[model samples]
Target: MRSEKEMMDLVLSLAEQDERIRIVTLEGSRANINIPKKNDLEFMEEVLIDDNMVFDIDNLKGFLNDTSSFGFIAKENNKIIGFAYCYTLLRPDGKTMFYLHSIGMLPNYQDKGYGSKLLSFIKEYSKEIGCSEMFLITDKGNPRACHVYEKLGGKNDYKDEIVYVYDYEKGDK
Candidate 1:
């Protein structure tokens, strides 16, 4: 298992690479003014890195300049344990969708309900903002997250698409 710091570094690096991911915020104790209010940054603690690293706050800000990004944090007792990053996009059908880029909790927090709660919040918020669909892609090796998503009513149309989609369109089926 990767250490907490290593896992967090991977998460941050992925977010930086994905242009769709616009916001990066930590949840636990401190308030990060960077993440927008649309996505609740309330739970997990923020990512803390050693000062020796070259990357700094200014670099992060420069990367996450788009205003359309949003994220969530899962925390317990003022300590961050997990986080999620997402972004919105307009589909070819002229409807909007929320794409869950990444969601993960620390090893100690796994099997707990934190992941479910965070996803639930994101689902509800997506509905509130008129998203016609919300979806995510998780590795097939990670059955735990897949189970959670299935339990929350996401469809298993992952055969060829490799995506779990939650369609909210009305009366089109």
Candidate 2:
């Protein structure tokens, strides 16, 4: 098997090169501030790449196949450290847009600008595809992610419950 770091680099580089990949987001318990317990497969399966952690692939695939999704894991050396996943939706106007479903860096990788690098790639991709805008939903609970988005020039467009809609126009990226 390839090293985890190698795998992460591959995923990010591929996303950087492909315009069809409009955005990269993350999902699952990893987005939760509370690190998940290892005993359950449900939470584990929600993550795209668990590294040495065991998860139910069949369950995860089933859940994702029902939607338009793309995911990537970040690695350093041979170890997996972070991930992002995005879900696409068709608007009533017949325009296609994608949401930044989830994004997370492993505890050790946080605040190191890796997330920005990934987001930059995603934004550039969205522009190349002629997308009008890109959106992301984050919680007031996850202020760190919000801060990151703001630093990247994201605008707050809407919010309901804990979900905050961070939007970027096509020309800005």
Candidate 3:
């Protein structure tokens, strides 16, 4: 298995080199605060070696399930600092669009152009695939992501409750 840093470096480098991986999206409760705990086996083991047994199976399952929905990750120096999850929606107009469910960079890695680089790659990928447009939904409360989407040329189409939909043509960038 690749070390965490190796995996992260690979992800970022692949994004840099490839053009068909349009619009990385992230989804599921991994972004949710009430989602439950994540298993930190390495940390836990290191901290509590004397314990007979302490595991939260249900929490582990939930965390695993949440992470499974994300199809890709962006890493820096072998650590996962960002990720995107995607889902495709076929419009009634016969146009197929890809929706970016979520994307985030680690706090320390924010504002380093990694997000834009990943998104540019995604947009190019969408164009190659014959997709006319790409869409994203973000919580209005999360202004940072919203700002990124707008800077990337996403237009707001609808807003209700906790989510806002932003869209852009494949080559709008």
Candidate 4:
């Protein structure tokens, strides 16, 4: 588990890498309210890093910068424990679809409903914003993630589906 300080640092570092992500906000406290609204900076917290919180930061700026981007955060005792990053895809019919790119919580916070809360928060928010559907892709090996997703009424359409990741830098594909 990463210390609260480490987690915040990781998030901040990712935000700073690209000018597109100007303001990063943490939301979803116990009251189910959103704090530090988009472009709101006063509510951001600073912490000193002493441990590692791992996640892929690649293309995060593009995701965060998208006009359709929106997500929820989980905090406890005034510290960030989890975050869900996502964006919406629009169709000619005008019904947008929400794609949950990623979501995770600290080790100590897992299996404690914090993840569920974040998922539930975003799921409802997506609907309220006119999203026609919400979906995400994950490795089947991650049973924990799959379980939580299913517990929240998520369906698996392609159980044997395989995912391929292509990392191209600068202009390579």
Candidate 5:
């Protein structure tokens, strides 16, 4: 565990390097994870402990039966190393795109060329399927992901785009 000051310094260093991080501390806002303020980590743990999980096997079965989405797994000597989930999207222009998500690789395989190769394969597969575009969330904070996407000719048309997420069905008071 790092001291709060050390952690702050590290965050400052990263913010300096990332243009997406416009403001640093002494701008004086308390983050949820900040040492002096709310502990979202503990909150997350408590939520995990308190919430009862119920899996809908029928829903999963229906999804498995549905088309228009697929996953690509990268394997080496019969061992799966990486995977990317993609869903087909039909645009108003009558062209299709692949909405890529849930891309992941084993920790030992990460930072290797396998991730690049897997992504490249996905692109090629998308092209083969007549997809006009591929869309995926590549946050600039993830410099490694950005680097890989850039090498693959991915474009960022909008800088500093704000994303809004709506979480469903949590009883709020």
Candidate 6:
């Protein structure tokens, strides 16, 4: 397994070299009262666990039923290297936007620039599917990821908003 630093390095390198990647932005913030002080790694671990439990076959079937929902994986020699989950929807004004829910590379593939490849694919695929913009969240303490987003020309103008989340199966709090 590759260290987090190595994965970060590759993500940054790809952002630097890729012209298709635009608008990289951090998602998690210090003001997020739900998650106090978890760093990127910790946040990712929690997300990984949640995804495993949430993306069961039945859930995926429902997700697939929604035309705006999409998921993709990066593979090399038939081996999975990375994955992305996203949802694109049309607003009341007829504008289309997508939320990049997750993007992650396997530890062993982190340094190989596969994350960038996966992101690139997401951009093109989103465009192909009629999306105009995409957004994602990253932890505030994850400077490495923030740097990559900045390098990719992502803007971070949002500030001071509380994130409210409710899992469908877990029911409302």
lDDT of each: 0.62, 0.55, 0.50, 0.63, 0.56, 0.55
Model 1 lDDT, residue 117, Cα: 71
Tens-place lDDT per residue, model 3, 1-173, is 65644433444344344432322332321121111112222322222223322444433234234422223444444344565556556789998787776665666778877677566656655566667788876667788778888888888865543543354643443
Residues 11-64 of candidate 2: C-alpha lDDT, one tens digit per residue: 444445543332233232122112222222222233444443333434443434
State the weakest 10-residue window (summed lDDT) of model 2: 29-38
Per-residue error for 127 in candidate 3, Å, reads 2.0
30-148 in candidate 5: lDDT tens per residue?
21111212222232222222333232333323433456755454555434455555788899999999888656666777887777777776777679779999988867689998888
RMSD of 4: 7.6
lDDT of 1 by residue, 88-131 (tens): 88888899999887787777888977777778777877797789
The residue pairs found clashing in candidate 4 are: none
- Candidate 4 positional error at 5, Å: 13
| TM-score head-to-head 2 vs 6, winner | 6
Scored by TM-score, the top model is: 4
Please report how far candidate 5 places residue 146 from its true position, in Å: 1.0
Q: Write down the TM-score of every candidate.
A: 0.61, 0.57, 0.50, 0.65, 0.63, 0.62
lDDT of 6 by residue, 74-140 (tens): 4554344455678876889898998888877768767455566566556666777677787788887
Q: List residue ranges in candidate 3 displaced over 4 A.
A: 1-70, 77-79, 159-173
- Give the distance in Å from residue 159's predicted Cα in candidate 2 to where it truly belongs: 6.4
Residue pairs clashing, model 5: none
- Which one wins by TM-score: 4 or 6? 4
Error of 6 at 26 (Å): 24
